[model samples]
Target: MRRIPILVTLLLVAACSQESERTYTVDELIADEALLSRTISDCRNNPGELRNTVNCHNAEAADGKLRLQNMRKALGG
Candidate 1:
């Protein structure tokens, strides 16, 4: 009786919680510099929590690729 209402309330609360954030791929992050910067900033700001996340990994990869590209361009290669 009372348990039914409690269960319903719990279900509603769980459903209203924040949805999981979608992760970006390395290529996607590379194509969006602003997003890449923001993601890197976020991962650095909360490293213990986000360092191992997919978004953080992709952001780091994208940053590496961009830096390598810049270096190549600078050397006229």
Candidate 2:
């Protein structure tokens, strides 16, 4: 009976250590895709915000764009 309690505790500990998978919906996926698409482009007209797209005039604004592209590539977008 004491051994049974130890085994149960071990099982619980193993289960708790397991990792869970994360799933995202299609809308979420598409929204992310759009954001990524925008990042790959350079907005010639606008020199202010990165706006998810690349901007030569606003190189400083490209931080999010570069980040978004890297993130999309990592996420398999």
Q: TM-scores of all models?
A: 0.82, 0.27
Question: What is candidate 1's lDDT per residue for 35-75, written digit by digit as tens?
Answer: 99999999999999999999999899999999999999999
Off by over 4 Å in 2: 1-4, 11-15, 34-77
lDDT of 2 at 34: 55
Residue 7's C-alpha lDDT in candidate 2?
100
Give the best candidate by lDDT.
1
Candidate 1 — which residues are off by over 4 angstroms? Answer: 1-11
TM value for model 2: 0.27
Q: For candidate 1, report its TM-score.
A: 0.82
Model 1 lDDT, residue 64, Cα: 98
